[model samples]
Target: MAVGSASYLELLLASDTDVADFDEPLTQARAKGAPADQLAELERERALALRVREILIGHRRHQAELQLLNDTAHDLAALHDLDAVLQAISDRARRLLDCDLAYISLSDRDRGDSYIKAASGNISGLLRALRLPSGAGVGGMVARTGAPYSVLSYHEDKSIIHTAEIDRTVRAEKMVSLLGVPVVLGRHVIGVLLAAHREQRTFSGRDVNALSMLAAHAAVAIDNSRLLGEARAAADELRVANATTRSHAEDLERSAAVHERLTRLVLDGKGVEDVVQAAANSVAAGAWCW
Candidate 1:
């Protein structure tokens, strides 16, 4: 029995299978009439194997998250449109969190509210266009606090200030659990990113961490997109300014050429007719005449 148990343990270690393999070995050991002590040891081994499997799974998940972040950064850099960038952020977040829905709310300081900028997964138009006033709703709380907020049941959670429009949208969408994190730049909360489930579910610490990481990435990407837009606009303005300068320089050069030609005519003892004709031709060719 001891030999059999030992061999089984060895087999488990050698195999690529996960904790599911534990059941088969334990059953076989029992059929082999293994002693109680042996069975206890086997149970311990099973627990250890499960823990190892969990660690491996967590490592793989972290790797996947990093890859997703990298891909998102590349997409953000390549995408020029703000809508496209927001859409990419929403899609990546939803896929990474495996949530029923994910969306972003951009802060509007002038209006003192947050408006939906992007959304993914099963969602209605009303929910997509939903707005949350500052200091209202879970998203607004995150915006105000600059932290991550989660609720097992949004309607049941009274701690968060609820607005009629947000409540109506949540009810219409049938969302049970919601998580929101601030998309902050420095100390300022720029926007909020939310992931919601249709069924009641508790968000684990890891879940919150992953969502927060994604939010951080999104915030930087959004800022970069805005900066890129401003840079393009500034470049266009500079181009226009440069063109105007060039036009003025050309006018001055033509004026100086005309003056020199008139002086040369005077020095050559030419008549007023020659100067008049030259000035007319020069004006027609290069300078504007009023």
Candidate 2:
């Protein structure tokens, strides 16, 4: 293998599209029947170049993923609309994973199951409405284990307990590959994030890690959104309560003022006609007395 300098890696970083400049010359040298030793060195250089290209591409992809995540975080911070955040998560997952579809299934602990809450890219109504029993499908397994799960070919995967409805839905969507990661908040698994492809595709460890990171952020965002919603509701309730308390205070103050006036009138030994006149003066001029 040809040893490369730090500068060479930096050059690749500068422009990933410059692969042809490094590859075409090596191809021509081989075709011209270069010396065996020279050819070997060239071949090593070519291999190193290819490796550099892969690294550059991976770096660029990772950067994109981070950018997407940062943008999502900003959006979540600005507003706590859960549906909007979930929808953004689904869309970003599909783009980052480069998959045909992506969806989030939230755990309904009360129901002991997970249900699809948000989806992006190609999807059917049946798939949208799909639910997985606890510890049943891939998502369910991820939910139970709080781990990441993947299958290059879902039809051939025997590790996951397949359900008839899930199988039918997957077939209908023509999804052959799947990757799911648990969305965890603290120690509890709150939901699962899923990425799917129509064709069989093997996901790398990098892919799994990227998806897992997104799942982690998603969990935080979901929790944040929920807390924000609760906080807003509590604030509204507090406002209503404050308004009621203020109204009651006003009513009490008015009653106390009337009582003070009546007490003064009695202390002064006012006649019944004088007391009635005082009461009449207390009432608004145009208001009717009961």
Candidate 3:
């Protein structure tokens, strides 16, 4: 069947011509005699063509999405501010995943707490005040495990403990479902990416996969932004140091000029005692002595 389809497809492709040239010969062939075999062949060709068309359409759609994703990644990477990148990531995730809330939390290693760095939706104000201890919540678990996690029912999940403080915030914000993925950079787990729905919703595998991809991208962007910030800071320090060194050099040059002038005055018959007193004053004030 495959071989026959291939042959018929080849014939059909051969029959394809410019619309202007699609005249007598092709019409007569179709009208006078399309045998059962030829008709079958035509049907096979049509089916193959339809499949190819669908495949092409799917491929194009995928390419367009990829391009869009790449563009977004590039834009995010161009942002050197950590807060800006986090905000962009959260906003994009909320929009793309169609979630009610999105947020990013960074681990406060010293205090053993996770604090929300950026969030979307109505909970932004509340999330800003929420904090979770290490190993306390799902987001914390993801941070500790460096893996992605989800809870369909935040209140019902035994593995997820809801602290009274956090529960009040959650209830006030009307959050029901939760998804969290760790942001890993090298061997370090930097933070967590979270998405929540106000209603009970099962996050599909595809949704998890997409969030994982976004997390990976966000991790790199965050890391790069940090590195860039450090680089800029180092550069600013170096520039300041250079300027200070130059200022010192100029001061030394001026001091040397003053010494030359004083020595010339003394050599040209000024009073030695008076010249000495003047030179002492200049030297005390950062001028060179003769």
Which predicted model would earn the best TM-score?
A: 1
TM-score-wise, the better of 1 and 3 is 1
Candidate-wise lDDT, in order: 0.83, 0.81, 0.76
lDDT digits (tens) for residues 1-290 of candidate 1: 46545655565456476456667777878998888988888777777766766776788888998888788888788877778887888899888888999999999889888899888985677877787888888898898888899999999999999878889889888899999988988889999999999999888787788788778877877788779888999999999999999988888887887888889998999999998998888877866323
Give per-residue CA lDDT, model 3, range 111-224, as digits (tens).
878898888885446778888877767787798788889998888888876688777777887989999888888998888888999999988775676677778877888778
Query: What is the lDDT for 15 in model 1?
Result: 43
Candidate 2 ranges with C-alpha deviation above 4 Å: 1-33, 272-290
Regions of candidate 3 where Cα sits further than 4 Å from its true position: 1-68, 280-290
Per-model TM against the reference: 0.83, 0.82, 0.72
Q: Is 1 or 2 the stronger prediction by TM-score? A: 1
lDDT of 2: 0.81
Q: What is the C-alpha lDDT profile of model 2 across 1-290, one tens digit per residue? A: 23233334455656545766666655666688777877677667667867978876888887987887788677767756678878888888888888999989998978888899888885578888888888887897798788899998998999998999999989988899999999999999999999999998988887788788778878988888779888999999999999999977777777777778778989999988988887787786423223
- At residue 247, what lDDT does model 1 achieve? 84
